[model samples]
Target: MTDSGLEFDLTRRIGGFILRGRASLPACGIVSVSGSSGAGKTSLLRAIAGLDSGLSGQVRFAGETWHDGTCRMPVHRRRIGIAFQDTRLFPHQSVAGNLAYGAARAPAGTPGPDRAEIIALLDLHPLLKRAVAGLSGGERQRVSLGRALLSRPRLLLLDEPLSAVDTARRNRLLPDLRQLLLDHGIPALHVSHSRAEIAQLADHVLPVRDGQCGACHPLNDWLAAQDASHPFSLLEGHLAGHDTENGLSTVRLGEASLVLPGLGEVPAGASLRLIVRARDVALALDPVPGLSIRNQIPVRIKGIRPQPGTAYCDLDLALDGQVLTARITRAAADSLSLETGQSVIALIKSATLDPAQE
Candidate 1:
């Protein structure tokens, strides 16, 4: 896994914009490239896949050399499969025909991917005979993925695969993509601007900024560092049990139970990533009984940092030693007489945590 997944050192100048970035992607799973608009994410993908001829850099995947300036490979010769946000399927072709387009591209003598495998991976079985133009947005995107996988690519490059669909459809298709990466062990370079997409799909994250590739970091930790105004904390735990009567899922953070509501149909023993916002956490002196908050973990106040008009308190929950931050007004802090070395309960609602399948 430490082997460099993808590398680029070329530069391209487009009018007033200079697109240049160097990064090393992991050798397995999804290595996500993220940035603001106009940060050259798509251009970078094209450069890596040999689709952009205007760039100058050595692009290498595994031990194979792709571009070395003098000898430039054509797109068709790259053996790389690319799937964009748009399905770009042939309007006149049937779904099977569209998929066969990629299937036909496999190298001579190599067995192509099975139709059922592609269909099951992307849930495209029902629409196998449907016309490309008749499929819905999500279905078309799934078919596009199937076509790309059937191409038998050495590397798969996806540029905002879910961006073209509506939010609801995007949510529906993400899990399928996740299963593809995990179950099939296909390595991918997934480009996106959405944090949630990266959280759900990426096992390794490469954050691109200012036309330069930065160091790799874990997806959750990198997301927490994005904003200083409202820093976030991450808790990684397994779904220990379910409380169906309360509509809450119990996450086992060491020995404590974190009850969050609206956890829709997650299987037991699945890893859960919980996001506890600083503003949503509250501190208490003793275990109160009359409050609506269900969590009352015994924690020690670690440190209290004060701002101009408010104060930020950091607490270390005993369970897994997870950190919980509470932003309170200066007056509120004074009223509670909060201080370091004090004991409190970290109040949290189940709705605040994102119940995603890891």
Candidate 2:
């Protein structure tokens, strides 16, 4: 099968609220649907997968017509894989058995991924023969992912897989899941209410507003919308090396290096994206050493955004081509004589996180 994009112009009414939106997913990247609870994220995903027949509109994927005014493809025939908050694995079955059940559904003689590749991608080798009853929340999610992949689906659907776990566990699991989606190269639509999950995983974002889905936007815009008071920024970097004595991971963003807490044993050259909040960053006109902070990156001011009811404004700073934001008082801005294209150093709190949140 081709690496096909999915598009839909759908409208569905459940109770008094109506869900209406039109959007498209790229041929080979994860698109995240984001909104508050009961805002139609799951409904939209369900409708796209042919599980909700109440929808009326066109559902097209790649070059094939899955649904329209005159035709509706059978849900089973649509070739989609799904993982939800409730993983619903068979308690009586081993993890391998549950995964194999998906493999068994593949049409004979159709060339697709084998179980071994899927197992490796999800890092399920250890849990292969374990009973599903003993799996943790994160482990269950992994099995669910494996089960979905083993089916050799054309498109994968994830509905709040991380939402089921507690904050701490969710933080650890996000990297693993992001790596899996990237490694498999499967086009997926991930549905979640957590901005952190979307920030960590999505290649593009579709924000759900008032039950209506908005057009997709680049990752930067979605991330920058976190909050006016606590503006968010996205940084791309690679693992420089681990400082075992300090128990930190050095992330190199261009020539700048940040010593982030919690040393993950990632490979030296693995690419990593960090979500930095304005509140986590401090500013200075010159470099100061031997402080509590572990990061002191020299950045040039790109622009400023003012927030209502506060003297603090968000500063958009640049390091090489990467962008970051700092929240500081307007008084500080004047005292430091900060301006667009002005050079400054940003002091990032070492504990800043992608759990971003705990």
Candidate 3:
């Protein structure tokens, strides 16, 4: 295995089912796994974590092999942080005690967050004194998340840690989870079935099908192939400035600048990744102003995919270097005479951003 990031090429059998997968996780940021139930998602994570001995082949990360036919690293020595759907907290431990248990496992001399930072990032201050047994599902997951981070693991394996939390708390905590991963800068493999979750969090996505790992795609391309409701694209940019009076902020998308509807208090010059839904993007042959859409960038059509069972097509547009998608009716496409290699303007309303996805 090349020693750049996390690599796995393995074969295993469980209950008469054969699983063969090969992938190299990105050196940084979240690389999420999506698959159906009983499709070997958890088994893959378990193999990487050294929790499943039945898996054969190899697992390597950060220039070291954790497993092979002749050599294996103990789970304790792998330096991985794992948070499953199950909280897995100590039955008798207080919230603080459980977190301490994780911090206690930190590898000597490796740099990571101290107790205070973990507590604040996951908003665990209120539950520090509470027993793990008494906390609500969301609260317990927070503790689990904190515990995982405190361990100072070089790799993180997350198995739908948000599945148990209520919808209200899930929405509120999504941003926190994004920030925590972004702040840590370690490579994390998140197992999830929700396309929204994958789009909201993952930089690179790997699709697992019938026990095999498939090619990885950027979030934008993955979502375009999804159903009509999931037409979205993520573009990386930087904050240009803010308009406090009008509640607007300017973001530079490649070569152009967009004045978005209020991104409260975001400082200028900070790198930002913005999410835009394809349905919200309207295409035009020429730049027109004065209506209401705040963003209109010149984009070249790179590719097109007709959305099955619908009258629309998804246009893969390249704006300078970044890519975005536009979902418009086929009739609209025919009327405008759109095709690959054609240049046009992509119009977007700034209000479509849900800050949580940023």
Instruction: Kindly report which residue pairs in candidate 3 clash with one another.
Output: none
Model 2 bad stretches (over 4 Å): 1-4, 15-17, 90-92, 104-117, 133-137, 165-169, 262-271, 304-314, 329-331, 355-358
- Span of ten consecutive residues with least summed lDDT in model 2: 349-358
List the candidate numbers ranked by lDDT, top first: 3, 2, 1
What Cα-based lDDT does every candidate model obtain?
0.72, 0.79, 0.80
In the range 199-274, model 2's lDDT, one tens digit per residue, is 7678899988778998798777776665544566778777888878877788888888888776465555566677
Q: lDDT score, residue 67, model 1?
A: 89
Ordered from best to worst TM-score, the candidate numbers read 2, 3, 1
lDDT of 3 by residue, 233-351 (tens): 77777778888888888888777887887455445665556778777799999999677776778889999898889898999999868778788999999999999999999998643
Using TM-score as the yardstick, the better of models 1 and 2 is 2
How large an RMSD does model 1 have? 4.7
Candidate 3 global TM-score: 0.77
With a 3 Å backbone cut-off (N, CA, C), the pairs that clash in candidate 1 are 10-56, 10-57, 260-350
Model 2, global lDDT: 0.79
